[model samples]
Target: MSRDDKGTISVRLVNEALLAFTSAALPAEQLLHQLGLVSVDLTDTDARIDVADFSKLWRRLARHFDDEFFGMNARRMRAGSFAFVCRAAMAQQTLDGALRVALDFFGLTFEGFRGELSRSESLAEITLSETSNVPPLRAFSYFTFWMLLHGLACWLVGRRIPLLAVELRCDEPDYTDDYRVMFSRNLRFARPTTRIIFAAEVLDLPVRRSEQELHSFLAHAPSNILVKYRDTTSLASRIKAQLREVPAEQWPTSEALAQTLCVSGSTLRRRLADAGQTYQAIKDQVRQEMATLWLADASITYAEIAERLGFADVSSFYKAFRKWSGTNPGQYRSLILRADEPIASRFP
Candidate 1:
């Protein structure tokens, strides 16, 4: 991990970790100490943590439960329990078939949970249901299952699955905005059941991975699933991609980005709202990412970087950078470039 890996993660990341420990009652101070995330403001919805530290926090919380499902308000899934299911999935010929195997395995293994698939001519749905035997699913647990299944489906098909929407039975949480980073913006809460929707056409896609790839994929396990999608269909992803395609004179305005997608400003704003972002928020994310890479080049002046990111002037860019990283570009540059690079990764 580089300095880039040092989050300023969404505070929801910590709250999600709490999902894995929902059944336990650990002292908050002791829990933070174990995770080395004492600096984290647990109550601050706007807070962020170093990515490396967040991973540590996750490991600490998960270990306490000794259950991979993280006590998801249902059953405690034993660590390494998913491997057998993956092995069964690899024996199938198609994604649909693999999913059937996974569904069967989960149904047999988990007492209060179920994995189901329902399809029509143009749409497909994978629903996760909870019976009365176990506690209700937490929002974090539901999100994890969605990510895990979605990630595996993509990896198995050697392509991304652009989800149309995600349905959650739980009420919206304090970290509603963070959901944008996880899934497509068309999220619906208070749904009858939890499910992910996509095109039915992908049902027949052949499984592309082999046992060797499966081994590597399993090494990361559930953590590997929590990744941002680069789908060409995703609004945020498309916005980021378009921001890179245009001239660097200044970043695109809300109207410009909306025009690129062949949508009205109101429509664009409505879509982004579902993903928990504003146009300016998307611009900030894109600009900060590009700016960080540009700033790493000491040969380039800050003014030049500002121009490249579409800032009217260097001052505005500097102010935006502070909001993104909590420090000025100069300070961030020093932390990132590291005059003498070390051999070790910032992550454990």
Candidate 2:
């Protein structure tokens, strides 16, 4: 779509996704025409489509296929990104050892996003963030990258530990059903950020694929695969989750938490210091997270969530949610739920 009408999905991911969908059978021209575009300009990586015409193209394609065009794009990106991650992971001796390789080398295959990986005694979270200006497709691309990471990790281990949770920063409707079908997990919408949360134990799963096999696969890997995690994780996700459980007024202080963890306040400060986190950092995280969650839940009154979150009132809550997610809670929830319904149903 035109950059103005709606953001175009990542060109690289979109290309790779489309390639996988056609099994490399569809020609470039045919694919563009199918999307209802008169032509394509691949020379410029950030390609544009006629947004006004997208619906027509999408509908025409939908008539011939049972699945939605966007869904097909999601599936294709998932497979291609999965293959790229598996190959990278196979290059390392241990799952933990290979994380850097997975993060750094992913760029060689995919573009348009970055990721950050962190480890704790109980959990390891890989936060995926969109780096492109293409809002329309960036969220989908980010989701595809996340699905690839989770899906391939499970596939490579020959077992599914599943994610502890999948969080999307976008304030869209409940695509939880589609997300569940794709990632096989509980999905949270209007989260402060996008992430795939899993028990650290999953990182211990052995890599079964051989390097030679991995090398062969990478040789033909598409150019659209994404490779690095951003610095979005740190304390943001944890803080946000904690906010959901604790009221803003009652939120724990960094010192109080340090005592609970049986450490000195200074020590607690030092740890978070090392990680580039702080009490205020956590507070902001919680605020953003709760705002998103409250917005997504149609059952929850805005005023109730606002009071719980320690906002002054409904208007304050509304202003904050808008600032965090870019859209009011109502609009975000509607978009996500509608987009995700078909995908979610597939799992059932």
Candidate 3:
């Protein structure tokens, strides 16, 4: 996907996430530099970080501190804690039971703070509270915990669980739009507590994932956890998912896609416009994401990639890729293939 796509994280968030490293006097600069970030990238207040690199930063921090909680709690949540929790939770019969297992594990891993699960007739909630003199948790801590819990829950149930609402105890941050995109749009800040509410019926959803499925999921690690489970029920997301199922060469026109979705062409256009999207933009995004993924495979040639992505020719693919990423395909491929090389050698 393009760097400006939904798969990117705001620099404000990147800075906030690095606070733990900064406070601990660790080598945040070295880590970011190794991950292809520079002084200008971090100094630019308006810049963003690619989601893939951000995920890599997360894994690096966990390894460096031996604390997956990012030093937010007095207790160190050891590196393998999440993996262990996932394995244990997998044996549960339902999402409600699975979440209880996860909450219990985290409760045992950390100190002072606790997570509680409750349900009304129609809604279920996960609430967090601190019981001791532990330092006050930041908004990032709460949101990160939610991402883990919610992401695991969705994986266990084999689908995205739409959050009905989210209540945060801290004041709103500048990255609220990112939160809206990641979790729910109906967010409330400075509330009495921090909790996520969802449909109570989701509690009974059977654990549909197998051990093999989970092994594959864990292989991608904390990075996939960040971007894979965002709300996919939007009209745009639904369309994108549908298009991804078929080859790009077979992708339908806007009118045909509208007919397939059981709406008139005008209604389809109007709804997508209302959602701040266009048919052509969605198509471009699909091609962009596919092109990037394909570029990572050494066996795929440029001519073959262009044909697979439905470009008329190699030159046309080059032009479209440059438009999407601001760099030509060859340069992008060099950067991707040499990601482990020195920073100076990897860029430009």
Candidate 4:
């Protein structure tokens, strides 16, 4: 397909791919015809399509086959402009250079989407903002775009896997199994916005693609993909974000936390206890998750990790690592390093 014509791969392709593994399925031509009538004029395989046209078709198709349409849309819709820019950036010699490329060119890729790669304390958040009226499709499109970006980054770094957590702004449903399968994480639904949370350390992974390879990829990068809506924050999501900010080392005592949250200490404790967790427990859980990512790298030493985590000393770091992982830092690092070697070897 021509670059402009290659909007997003249609849901027809995905459905066909899935049907390949099953028997007694819909015919490919029939499926394609139905998708075409609902979406773009697929009969003219080379026809160009933009976000507005795609969104209209998606809304129509969604009404007829909400589940299938949303599923396929979630898988295919991506940040086409961002993808092109990222591919170009990957051609640069260093990660820093590539990041500069993203910063400089991201605006040129998508007109409405706003993105910021910013540092908050020690954490670097790559935030993407999408303002659209159709919240579900928009959220799904952004979710898919983030997944593609994450997947592409892993592919470049030679770590072809998903991130730690994929947070979605959509409502809770039985989509957990599919979300986990796609994102490889603790999937959170009914949140404020769609986000893929990973360690900032991932940005340090070395770029493997050469300038020529990147040029080739960008030369044919798909650019006419549709945009979808992402919704605003809900009350529960606001609470979750507030709790997320209280990392283990920074978590206050129950009374202190309750006061900070503007509630009585006993009430706060009782609420969390009823949810089957305590404030301390959630803080530890978040810390443990963060620690796992940090420990996976060989370059970071135990002392440095302890200091970063606000631990008292190496002994404390070791103890906590063992408690969280059931293994010492040395053993955990060894296992990760060994797993990493094969990935590195493939890229090399």
Candidate number of the best lDDT: 3
Candidate 4 residue pairs in backbone clash? 138-228, 138-229, 139-229
Q: Could you give the candidate ranking by lDDT, starting with the highest?
A: 3, 1, 2, 4
Tens-digit lDDT track of model 2 for 215-259: 653443211111111222334334444555766898777778666
Provide the lowest-lDDT 10-residue window in model 3.
339-348
lDDT of 3 by residue, 57-171 (tens): 7777787779887777778888988889999888999999999999999888877767888775555678776663334467788888888899899889877786655777678
Give the distance in Å from residue 42's predicted Cα in candidate 1 to where it truly belongs. 2.0
Candidate 3, residue 118: how far the Cα is off, in Å: 1.0
Which stretches of candidate 4 lie above 4 Å from their native place?
A: 1-29, 33-83, 96-107, 132-139, 160-162, 211-348
What TM-score would you give candidate 2 relative to the actual structure? 0.39
lDDT of 2 at 241: 48
- TM-score against truth, every candidate: 0.60, 0.39, 0.65, 0.41
- Residue by residue across 42-142, what tens digits does model 1's lDDT show? 77766667545655665555566666565664456665656777778878889999888888876776666677887744556777766643345667778
The RMSD of every model to the true structure, in order and in angstroms, is 18.1, 18.8, 18.9, 18.3
lDDT of 4 by residue, 1-348 (tens): 222222344443333223432235655446545666443343453344443444444443434443322333323223244446667767866554565576556444444444555433323345455455445433344555554455445445545432444556567542233233345335556555455544455566678886675555433322211111111112222343465575546656778767867899788767776655666555555565566667756688888888777789999988876665445667645543442232211101
Cα deviation of 333 in candidate 4 (Å)? 23
How many clashing pairs per prediction, in order?
5, 27, 0, 3
